[model samples]
Target chain A: MPWRRPRKKVERPIEVTRSIEESLEDAAAGEEEEDSVDLAGLDDATVVEAATGEPEPERGASDLALKLRETLAREPAPARARPRATTYPESGVDLAVDAARGLRLRNPVLTASGTFGQGIEYAELIDVARLGAIVNKGTTPNMRPGNPQYRIAETPSGILNSIGLENPGAVEVARRYGVQWAALGVPVIVNVAGYSVEDYVYVVSEMAGTPGVVAYELNVSCPNVKDGMIFGSDPSLAAELTRAVKAETDLPVIVKLTPNAPDVVAVARACEEAGADGVTAINTVLGMRIDTRRRRPILGTGSGGLSGPAIRPIAVHITYQVAQAVGIPIMGAGGVTSAEDALEFLMAGASAVQVGTATFADPLVPLKVIEGLAAYVREHGLRSIREIVGTALPRMVE
Target chain B: MIIQQGAVTASARIGDLGTVLGVSAPGIAAQARAGQFVHVRPGTSFEPLLRRPYSFNRIRRQEGEIELIVRPLGPGGEWIASRRPGDLLDLLGPLGTAFVIHRSARNLLLVAGGTGIAPMRVLAEQEASRRNVTLLMGGRSVAYLWPSDRLPPSVEYVTTTEDGSFGIGGRVTEALPELLRWADQLCACGPWPMLAAIGRMREEAERAPAAPGRAALLEAQIAVEQHMGCAMGVCRACVVVTSQGNARVCREGPVFPLGDVAFAEGEPATVGLVS
Candidate 1:
């Protein structure tokens, strides 16, 4: 007889088809009287994340995320998040004393002139309704294509872009974005650039009474080809341009300063003195990248502005200095990718923050930063964020 | 077109299909067109941060599988070639301007170089028996040439190889002058040099107006390629110079009338068209 193998039993992987509430019922069925031994050493935070399906809590987050979170938190997001327990007293977060002209933005996270093109591109990514206001791309009197290839360059931490104010011009932008801006449920700020004083007047005047336009950001930092006056580099010229813009349009005027300026504080002071509503700091720092293969300048213009993470330290420094010199609100921008980055600016004395290249990398950066700040605020037992403003400034040694 | 494929759709290879697009999608048989292309995303899940574009070589409608003929130039193309059939691709479209048919013209000529043959095949198939068509195909060698079986049986096929490994030892345009005299309209899509040659020849022929009714040369259109970023007209990265300044290759055209374009050299093939 042939050697016969015993009948084999096939085992299949068990399929767990737990019903909606069956798992709970099973747990209830196993109710025990004796206390269970704690063999698995898990932390409380881990338990909370597992139960809630949330990421594990992070420790030692930079105050930057908190600042961005504070401003983003002010946005009346329908779903309220329970405040976390890590927030501190106003180290740099502030929600009080903010206005962009007549527009009552809770805080000043105004998009920089060229950075925010239109509301539609970032509609899903940003809480457009919650932003203090959305700034339009730098526009001109005539529809211009702006700059050539490589207008925007990616730096280590940010991006350097010389879009040369490429835009649909004031007429087209106003017509296209006017109604959409209003629907954004936020203030619509248009960043206007001009080769001449009339160009500024004409573009602003065209939008003077438009319902959606909450204010005008005078892109005075632009290289003026007409009068050979660099509006941002020269304080007097910046002041003059600001006053001229103020006289021409009823819209609140914001003067954006160039980081390329020798003294950023004086320029901020000048814009504030010129009756401008507020100021935006540090357009991309002029820089260039070399194409190793071609052995020539990578940018067609030979130079471009650098942005991203590399510039945040500089932006915070500038904001801190400018806030000290000017009473007007300071909208700080640079390499802000997280709430922690945004907090640094606030501590430096900026009331609001603008996110630039980070949006390109992660559209959710702003929202995450906002959520992070709220968690921080609540964790620290602070009722409001104003307690943190200017907390990092060095006290006089006298 | 809605293509439901398991995963091979995202595996796109990169061949110099004449133009450059920054962000492209739909790699394998993703619903595409003859002259159309899908934007290839450079990385897995938005990491590389930019999308590349590729031409749709052929479409397998029954299987909802499309083919892309590519030569990998970057990690992205290598990435597409490595994917297995079951991989799901986040593909976009059969986008950009397609070849336009002139019902009036009875004869057609299709000139292709390298992978440019992909889109032209679609037009060739549509016009196969209905009209007279002559396909002038050129490549590096006979083996490197497109499979002749893919062409319509009605088309008179001709091939040229640079190394004399195929039918003729010269460029495709070597046979064009004689053909141009006979073919009513020339719709050539390929390298700028070849199209520019056609442009020059068309210009020379037009200067004389080809003795009255001898089948006037229909306006020639070439499907130029570029580094297109946003398939929509937003980014302005895919702009080619036109007689009317810059025009978007992705939005306004991937195909243009040969006469209207101003070709730029060096970085990549640059096309200028009359917008």
Candidate 2:
């Protein structure tokens, strides 16, 4: 057991390098000159270069782009130089905010479904509401007691958990949290999983009308279950499931893929063609843990999915592949606990990032990652994240 | 709810106590209770990402620090074994509900597992500080029992071990009937089976009248352990069933009145114990 320490008394304004906060006060000093630099319409390489190739800030690489916002200490008249931010709030000291598919976020970081709870409990230790959005733990069709004991097994640098998607089903969830979700200041993405294709469609369709839910993530990669995960691995099955959910609701549907698949692109493409609005790249990598004393598998389910920093590179690879194959935005995940890691995924092709296992280790990982991203962009003189999306894909097969 | 691993103040192998490590935090001693625990923060080890909950064993007034006693289970527990004085560790604190003692209750019977003594030690000390207190401590053997050096001399002590290697063995509950007959209030902390047995003992004793003076007091309180997630109740990993359904052991309580909580037969869950 660990003990506490005296709270550190130091309080300093969070550091900033380059951004609008510094320029806001200068409006009274000069005429309005629009800095409307559009990186869009630029070829993919140029946009990528504009985003990733710009010189990084010298003061702090770990500082989030939002943090580096050098705003004028005093407010000045609004001129053409500063156009009103599109729907998203820019006044926050942290700059992870952006808008996509009608969803507004504080940052580009979130916890993968099943990795974080409803976002209330960690509030005392972590800034839960400050995150881009919180994806509640995966909810199933019926109340699941979950797997037997020893559900989690530690690995060399990761964890294998066969929680079996334990949760209170949809109706009860709506009964318990419908009001709270509506009240939260941030967007709430609910992750849904099921035992059968019909189960998946039902959960999705039900969530479509559920209040407080802005988007739904379909779990297709869980290795702990006997049924739901298999559909995620088979392209045809995934396509059918996606189509079924599409026919039932108009909500933005994000198909969460499994790294266990032989070709993740096949699964991603299938979901896209079937009408998924977007894709969340790479779920946990299938893994196992053993107990020598019992001469048996450590987890009751025999196998679990591996998460944390161990799966980062694989997630990036899958994200890159899927981005090229699909037209909708991609949400990248797996071991992304830092801003640089988020940047890596954005360069790889994901429009956003999720920090999963790192949340357990450090309550502040997501908030820090968001700030870090903004700091990265500002230091390099990039005006918007659109400049860097998919910056790392090769210009050609060269 | 503020959880952060602090540096280790000291680590030692106390005879029979298994291993003892001290984390440097000033707040826990002032705020921690007998049944509540701080989730152990995740260490560099991959086995456990969450903090481990340890019962507060002893608070040395002279040192102005708290101590935790535990047995090594794996790399995670062994990590606790590896700490040296001044080594920082992840600590989340003053967690769970405490053993509730009514002001009217005088006599107290305290039951403990190998090192479940951590938090109970504080209760013992607090009660001993003001009034009379008796402790009925159970262990696997005399060696598995914590030495009295960390405890106050004022605590009236009773001992029992499984092998009868020291005091009366068989089971800790065996010692409880006598204590339950005498104590106005009882507090127990130990492995689930021992706790359940103690729970059973309380049930049997409830059928009989309390020794003359103690009529209004209900049953004893037992600390239930489970897989603790964020210690903040975010994961809902630490759960216990009650008439009201499941409640988080980490957030609702490690200490709960035996009569109020629903009991299920299963293996003991050592959640935040690895922090």
Candidate 3:
């Protein structure tokens, strides 16, 4: 049987490009940096010496400064203007971020549940191990066939889907994917969904000791199921469900909040009060589309959850609100398509961000987000990504 | 399956039928099989959020090229159909199951409706040399039909049009009976209504075990289409009800046994645990 174990950092061949910090130090020491360097604050004498390997001759310092300034102005800022990082990080930079209260992941970018499959499908085309973790399709105690044809409908910039949490059930999921998830070398956070508090406890109990599974994401806000949003919409109900699930397993429990909730911040605060480890700021917003020809709702279900770039603003807003209301880390999920979008969530106080609908268009987006995050860290010269978390949050009044 | 950028080597319009794009993707071309499809990213933008799935219209292995028949149905299709030579396309494929032919079957029959002609054309070219291949295609009008000159010389081509502007005047099912008796095996790919029509024929033939061409109808295989997302078996958006319960069209299918698939009242049956 496959069991969870500590993942060792596999040594990767380092690329020739040095970190920006190193380049900065080398520039001040009169050493030639590999390619790009920032010479913004260095004196004219130092700049001339570095460029021509000889000290500037005795002359009018102002004239020499003007000539040097003209030369510098003619050249482009190669450090900032160079090509964006398109490849994975070579070494020595930490991209780790907290996925939960104590669940530190290797990166802050993860594939949202349902969009990434069992984490094995896209493993063929891109590197799955590069992600912080993969949340499998929402799991229930029993198998579900899911909704009918027209289960998906495209909206303005997103898609409306009522997949109804189609999965092989929790027992089969742990038995089938446990080994594969362990072998894939990525953490698994099972997205648990159900109709009752007992249902949530049962799924967590069943998946308790599954290998490679680091946490449980309670999907209280799935809009496709009958009364699926009941727990998420009510704070007392959300807390009661969270407390019961927390009693069943030692794994971290993250409650996924619904934007449809009348008071999302209260629900998040209640979950945190009930021992929930973290919360996903927002689930898909309830929406629908009409077929002009048929004069009926396009989705099999009259309304489905809307996800994609269309909901990014809503997700970020909810994340910022929930971050202020609770002390638990928030996993921001919506239509996060790029590193900039992910950064929006990180600065808004989300510990990590999940990539969903965007994966449908480009399978490599999760990896690209990771690469972009590392690039962001290097360019800004930040010691770790955590320093930027909540950077944009409103400062608390003393 | 592989995800790679392929350059457009050839592009042409087939009357009012659709545009056939020839892409040079050696990796995908080498791995492609009949009935398999490629999920193509429409453009660099994200407005058209999902990749479009297109069946392989032609697979030229030695030349390291594959072709797709694309109809401009929506924004995504329009962008892909308007591609010019030397344009690069991001493709994720050769994915899903392929149509399987019994080696001993000497007479093979293929059926296509509308853009479903993509895979049928592939099979006709691949099976023509070793078997007696016959192609029966149906379209809305003469302009919507595939050019006969594009197919191999050894294959027998038949046509039908709803408007009676081309070959035998009617849907493909109308001309299907005459050839059913001669065919040892059959394969089809088309819109849901056409596939459901063939499913009906198979059901009727099953009730009469001794009927002419019963074996061919029983062994027939077909490809299906649906509103898809991800096309990587994750979203569960393109599932269809079958004998084994709900199967993803982008994964377990896009190809399945004729009898295993379920249809209701000339349309794909609604799938779920509830009624």
Candidate 4:
């Protein structure tokens, strides 16, 4: 049986480009009296035409346009002078933001904890330098062999995992990956998880001076282990754990919130009150799946953390609510697979976005998100990505 | 490992086994080994989200082609199985560790079940010229057996079906003891139950007196399978308990020493190994 479909070659409509050019010309004529043509809203093709006095290349045209626009946007010219520059920006678009107190990243795209695996695994597939930061897997005071077989199961537009905070303990993680992390170029954020406050403190202390580690993301929201969600679900316990980690090290402490918590916003506030430098709004939601054939749960742990595009909307809602309640910068995470998904968090008041389950589907997703964000910034004429943060929030009347 | 958009050169169904897809991916084919696999995307979008892992069924470097045996078990599998010539496939491969055949071993035995014949076929083609090779395959029916004509002529092909419609009846395990005495090494790939059966046999051989084939079974290396994500070794989703603790099937294996793997209750032993 031959199961082949005839290959369909997509033909780009040439009229689309002509029509865009016509509209750009009209906009340019109308703006001539304003002393400067706002080419910001123009499509990349028209931007390339206006900048280089030539048509865009069939391939890599958008990338070239972004690079050119970034360069022009950086170097300021006299009020009415024509913008001309062939150089690429030394530092690309201002995608940088204060991820945590004293923890500033070069960009706002970070690889989420657990999914990044100490940053070594994906380095073979993508350039680690392109990411804002890499959050290593959750580390505990003792080595964890993790959960049993059937650790993963696919759900609609998502996956459920019961990894159970598997790691080689804090000391071993620092010893095994410290030197490598130092040379990886990307900043490292250690995700600390444990059954007790001492476990969290011990892990923090052990990883304190490890090279390349810029901060700590307290993983109190891991739902796969016993007592893992206790701190995350309670305000006092969350504050106590945050305070313990803060006392153990001077590194910025960011608490990852659990959506299963009774009041996620209250927990965020509690962490902030306990001196947390930042907050990551929303970890995976608690979920389960049953194998119909076997008439039992699919995961070995009975239930697992649900993540992917299916949870993106829930994550955004939590981020929106938490952003309104807290002053600390929020690191939004859920099922962010695209730049548009990341943009939703940013507009809802998140300073950066962590890509988790999406990486399992496409390792290049985080890099693609970075590029897409740059395109969005250029298209909107935004001076800095920080300007877009909290834009969706209700404003107070004067 | 490189990620490439491979073009499907051919896709066809073979009896009751499933669809076989030939992909023109030079990079993957050039580096692919017997036991390693490729993670293939089902569609352009994330609806059927995760990529399915398939071992290399055939690798032709000169033609820059690699073939995969796709069993249409789910929506993702069905989509991949139905792909036609000239279709672009997103592939990340030549991943996981390959089977290691000892240089001194002159007689090699390979066991396969159902679609697990993929990696075994590669071993037969690769090691036939270097050593005396025999392959034992088992299926529920004759329709599920791999075609004997497709294999290298030098390979000794043995088959068993549950319904006795093919070669020997029952299972590969029934034919394994006799062949164990003649072989110097054993390697297998199949469902967990089959591997568990082999695991049990290995345990019995260890407890008994030293025999010609018992050493080979004890030293056997088998490629294992599990529900996987990210195949890049980051997700920690495909881990199985081993003598060395939890090991990711996508990285540390797909291939592992039979003795090192801990199987319990007909599935991978998941409890009590660690606290």
Q: How high is the lDDT of residue A393 in model 2?
A: 83
Better of 2 and 3 by lDDT: 3
- The predicted structure with the larger TM-score, 2 or 4, is 4
Error of 1 at B17 (Å): 8.6
Tens-place lDDT digits, model 4, residues B81-173: 989999999998878888888899999999999989999999999999999999999999999999999899999999999999999999999
TM-score of chain B of each: 0.81, 0.87, 0.98, 0.97
Q: After superposing candidate 2 on the true structure, give the runs of residues whose Cα lies further than 4 Å from its correct spot.
A: A1-106, A204-211, A222-229, B5-7, B10-12, B27-30, B42-48, B59-64, B203-218, B240-244, B260-275
By TM-score, the candidates rank as: 3, 4, 2, 1
Q: Rank by lDDT, descending?
A: 3, 4, 2, 1
Best by DockQ: 3
Candidate 3 C-alpha lDDT tens digits along A1-398? 01112222221112323333333343233222323243555666765443322356785679776755543332212122122322346133466667788676767888898899889877656656557789989999898878777889887788999888888998999899987776565678999998888788889989987867888999887433446557898898899889999999877899999999999999999999999999997789999899999998888777899999999999999999998898999999999999999999999999999999999998878878887888898999987788899999999999
lDDT by residue for model 1 over B1-275, one digit each (tens)? 21122355344333333221122233334335556676654444433444456676666565666666655555556665555556555454556666666797788888888878877777787788788988888887776577777677888888888889888888887877777666767777777677767766666766775552234343777787765444544445566666666666775678777667675442223322111
> Over 4 Å off in model 4, which ranges?
A1-91, A222-229, B272-275
User: What does the lDDT read for residue A381 in candidate 4?
Assistant: 88
On TM-score, the leading prediction is 3
Writing each residue's lDDT as its tens digit, candidate 2 over B114-151 gives 77766677788878866667887888788877677766
DockQ of 3: 0.37
Candidate 1 or 3, higher lDDT?
3
Report the CAPRI category for model 3: acceptable
Candidate 1 structure quality by residue, lDDT tens digits, A1-398: 01111212222111212121332232222122110111123344533222222333664344433532333323221111112111312223333235444334544455555545576555422345435566777778988765566444444544455555656777888788776665454567777888877788889888866645667877766767776867898888888888989998766687878888888788888888889888877677888888788897665566877777777788888888888888787777887777788778877877667776555444445555555565566678754444555667776477
Sorting all predicted structures by DockQ, with the top scorer first, yields: 3, 4, 2, 1
